[model samples]
Target: MRIDASVITPYPTFAYSVLDRYIDGDIIIDKSSALIGTSSGIYAVMGDETNDDFAPMLMHEFKRREMLNQRFTLFSSSERWDRRINELLGAKLQRMPRYSFTFNEHRFMQSQRAGIPDGFRLNRTNKESLEVNREFDAAYIRKYWGSVERFADKGFGFFVTEHDVFAGECVSIFSSEQYAEIDIVTNPLFRGKGVAQCVAEAFILECLERQITPRWDCGLHNTASIRLAQKLHFAAPETYSLYVRK
Candidate 1:
């Protein structure tokens, strides 16, 4: 489900959050001010450009305070349900498009077939593990790869270090809903190695030992991430759609 660009003027913050989950969308525009977030950059209407940003600008006008009570759903499989729910916006639920890749939890420790080059080890992102996350921000993350803080308040990871440079990291985000969100990121120089798959295996084992079900998400166009997930064990592909007031 995608919200048209013109409707974000009044509530840009909410709109920015929406884009992190949207595919083929960027630059939410409006007037009043510019508010950019991690997933996509936000732009506000100004000077002669006012007419160009009408899409997001108008979205704000149509949003109702009652919408605060409305809920947007992310289905396990996207199936154009969001369009069907548009008529019920103020009265019932809001549907959005989202595709989830489900993977089985690894219970037993596999062999060391996956290697992390040499002289590096997996570490957690918690207070005790390491702090590579502080040095890395969202902007740098958007290029070629993206990663989550993984339960930020209580993050855990294996920091692959090369002579102490903090090369890359891995994590498994845990939510109360019992969903397994696998997250991994490597230093740009270490792209083609089996680093991610290695960390993912360990992460899945961690989730299984805790009894959590793993889940995966990627843009419909991000073939690399999608393939990696499938290779690492995302059972199959399931699609969901999203919709918002135009």
Candidate 2:
């Protein structure tokens, strides 16, 4: 059964991206007892834990779909949901801490500018770039946004290039009416040259121009990601537990 997205609380922006039809996903509701919003192997679970029938049904569905073998992740909405998932999945679940950061416009404006390195060019992502950029991988956009055409139409990003080679890119992995979640990748050869910051700054500027809030999220152990977010003036880290299949 399809459930109202409004009833699901404390959801990640990706879930809303699915619910709002900005991206393709599944909304699985168990007779109004529980709901699961899923897209691109990421799942958000919420609703009545006291319902005895829901957990077993969810477990069965997971096994039937071979979700564990496919490397799926589940986000818990509360401590109760955490306990419920633990009870159902047991040793199959590996708990990990994830961090989210809120953007600070003032700090971002005050931060030192990210200058493109000599001989490199920063450009907005377009259909042609999406087709030609191999280092950044068009597969990622397809995986998250369902197609290059959709992303090129509704999403935006910035990529760095040197002599026509892809150096780095920062893109909206998920976007809704009001939010754009950032994802970045830099060619290992170009790392430590501020390539990431350059593209990220461009992406953020585009988001701001559109009045959409930019979001940053990463695993707790991803020090590099945390550092970049902080450098970009994304403040106030809120930590949460992310559950993945073992």
Candidate 3:
């Protein structure tokens, strides 16, 4: 069943990426309930929690199709939905804390800036640059956007390179009309340096120009990511539960 995209409220940016057709994904609707699944194995459940039989039926279908695996994480839209998922998954579910941040323009502009190292150059992701970095390579983009061509058309990223070596990259892992979720990776050799910030700043600059809200999400244990986000002036950390298969 197909449901109106407007009905699936309070979803993560990735789910919106799916719902808005910015990326390829699976959508299943049953009466007032809906499930949106992305290629990266993240799923969002929204609407009527009283539909007790919906989730189990979908689980059965997933198992039959061999798609019920340990790699998937589930996001529930509300507390009632959370309880429903817990009841359905039982001991197989492990809840983890995820932190979400809002971008603050004034703080970002006020934050200390990091200049690209003398030999380093920041470039937007293109056919040539995508082939240079494994972290933001064709495979990674395909995993999120379904195809390199689609990503090239709708998505944008920035990567830093020193001579010919890839230093770090920041890309929109998922996006919709109004939001772009950030995913960053700094090479081990460039970890202590500001390559991440520089590349990420370029990505943010483009987002601001495009009128898209850049979003940052990280797990509680990823202290480094949290610190970097704070340094980039992404404020108001709100914690949410992410249910993983155990």
Candidate 4:
């Protein structure tokens, strides 16, 4: 049976913890688990792998709910369900390789931070600045960060500006008590000038100061992101699989 996001809020997975805040009723909670769907597709599933009915129940409800599409990505936090999902879906889907990396505070402290270029200023994202920078994509910001007010309270972000114009941003795409996933973008005019790196460094420092580890996850093929993560001192990447609609 479907229940509230709050009902599954204590599932003990980083994915679920992050989803809890923005689900806003776009989820299904059974006795022991929950499935969250987004406009893009099934975003994540959280439950006990040991439960015999867990996988089946998830599959059943996912079909019954008529989620956005038949083909989409699903995040799995447990290995038990990974095999079960693969066996059930088989070649009807494609397995995509991705990387998950996290910061080691000790190692990060020993690394060198990138320097921001001259004439650029870094600032924390706030309601006032966000309004002034009308160029920032409103829909994209809302979809990833939720309301700007909530972001200010629960997450952290930094943006680099050049002569009072927006240049780039490094923001927490998903955050739980223990970790904050980093997301960054650079304006075309500012690309190749290291603006992204500087902003990302600011975001990382904030996370470290607050004792929250920074996380970096990206597709294996995303070379640019991989380079940035390595440069920022993220630990070696670990491989994981997810499904993409065929």
Deviating ranges (above 4 Å) for candidate 4: 1-42, 46-52, 64-72, 78-80, 90-93, 131-136
Q: Could you tell me the TM-score of candidate 4?
A: 0.77
TM-score of each: 0.52, 0.88, 0.89, 0.77
CA lDDT, candidate 3, residue 158: 88
- Model 4 lDDT tens row, 1-246: 453434543222335434555423256566676666554354566665556666676667556544544445677655665776677665555677788886677776787777788889888877676666534444555665556766667776888999888898877766666667777888889888889889888988888788766778888999888888888887777777676667
Return the lDDT, model 4, position 153. 75
In lDDT terms, how accurate is model 3?
0.81
Give per-candidate clash totals.
27, 0, 0, 0
What residue pairs clash in candidate 2, if any at all?
A: none
Candidate 1 lDDT by residue in tens digits, 67-158: 55332222211122233234334244343444457564342334333655666666555543433453434432332123333334322345
Q: How accurate is candidate 1 locally (lDDT)?
A: 0.45
Candidate 1 has its poorest 10 consecutive residues by lDDT at 40-49
Give RMSD to native, each candidate.
Answer: 12.7, 2.6, 2.5, 4.5
Model 2 earns a TM-score of 0.88
Superposed model 3: Cα runs more than 4 Å off: 1-10, 61-71, 110-112
After TM-score superposition, what is the CA distance of residue 3 in candidate 3 from its true location, in Å?
Answer: 6.6
- Please report the candidate that would top TM-score against the real structure: 3
lDDT of 2 by residue, 90-188 (tens): 677798879888899888888788778888999988878877776445887888888888897779998999988788988898887778998898999
Ranking by TM-score: 3, 2, 4, 1
- Tens digits of lDDT, candidate 3, 1-246: 565555644468888888789988888788878888887777888878788658776576445334644357788677787778777775767888788888998888787778676789988898777776768888988887998998888899988888768899888998888788889999998888889889888888888899888899999889999998988899898877788766
